[model samples]
Target: MRLQKFMAKAGIASRRKSEKIILDGRVTINNTMIKELGFKVDPKKDIIKVDNKKIFLEKEKIYIILNKPVGYITSVSDQFNRKTVIDLVSKVDQRIYPVGRLDYDTSGLLLLTNDGDLTYKMTHPSHEVNKTYIAEVKGIPNNEELKQFKEGLKIEDYITSPADINIIKKDKGKSTVKITIHEGKNRQVRKMCEKINHPVIKLKRVSFGDIRLNDLREGDYRFLTDKEIRYIKDEINEK
Candidate 1:
């Protein structure tokens, strides 16, 4: 099998991240550093080490949901002196990483897991897992602007896919809007509102796929219920 896929199957990291490790020259096969992207090895026959530590695929999987707060990055490590999601999930015994990214300034529901295949399935754009967010904007959005968002808007080089937008509450100057989209592009929600001239002031992701944050507080996390896990697994399988 491909080296990256092997590492992902072992639960060390996602396939993309495993490729990064290989490119960084941290991964070695039989004591020889291998930096090639296309390198392959049999999990049963080859000795793999990442950063000089013996690596093995995990036999058990863990999934978790976190109510991520602002000021934390979605990365496993950061070089810019910023806090990462992993720091807040120290209570989890096994090492895990965020399934997808949430910007440093954005807060809300985020999923973390050691299950690479599930991570790939959920984060991959083809699965179209819906993510719901409540965004508080600086000014109220007009019908035309809302319609534009629902129909889709051009932001920079590409036009966004049609998104679900509902006016939850409209006040004197500002409004609370619920927006749902399946794409996980960088700063997507913020950019979408920017396209409608209603830049977001506060954004909170309330749901991802079938999971909801409910009353989970910032920095708090919980394990996925057996039924929830099974439902997600089945959903992925069906796709």
Candidate 2:
């Protein structure tokens, strides 16, 4: 297989990212640094190394869901040494990575896995997987604001796609709302609330597609059930 594909299969990263790793001159085969994207190797006989560490194709694919708590970044490592989702799953022996990402201040269901193909499909914009977030905003939005939110809002340079927004509760100066979005743009939910003049006080993702966060406690994680795995694969396949 191609070098990048091999690296992705070894649970190093997604195929696109593996290409960058190769171009960055971080990969080597049999002690020879390789920068070619099309470089192929026989997994059984060739010795592959990324950043000087030998890597082999992972035989077991592990999938996990974490009830991510606030203050933890969704990454394998932190340059500033802050907590990351990987720290929460230190006991898991296999090399796994977050499927996508969640902001440091945002909390809730986060998927981590070594299944590179699934990760690639789920993160791709073409899949358009729906993700639901429960957000607490500074104020209750008026009917017009709600309408604009559902229809789409101009934020920065690009306009957001149509989303589903519902008022879950309104008390005092704050309101709890449910927002479901198909695109996973950075800080999209927070920016959308801000555009409506109701900045988010807190945000938590409750579900992605049909996989609900349910009653999972904060900072805890569990392996995905077989049915859940099947559902995810089927969801992507259908798209």
lDDT string, candidate 1, 103-146, tens digits: 99999999899898888887777788889999999798889998
Per-residue lDDT tens digits for candidate 2, residues 1-239, read 88888888899998888899999999989999999988989898899999999998899999999999999999988999999999999999999999999999999999999988888889988999899999999989999999999999999899999999999999999999999999999999999999999999999999988888999999999999999999999999999
- Where model 2 places Cα greater than 4 Å from the true spot, the runs are none
- Error of model 1, residue 77, in angstroms: 0.9
Model 2 deviation from the true structure expressed as Cα RMSD, one decimal place: 1.0
> Candidate 1: where are CA atoms >4 Å away?
none
RMSD, every candidate, angstroms: 1.3, 1.0
What would the C-alpha RMSD of candidate 1 be, to one decimal place?
Answer: 1.3
The TM-score, computed over Cα atoms with residue i paired to residue i, of candidate 2 is: 0.97
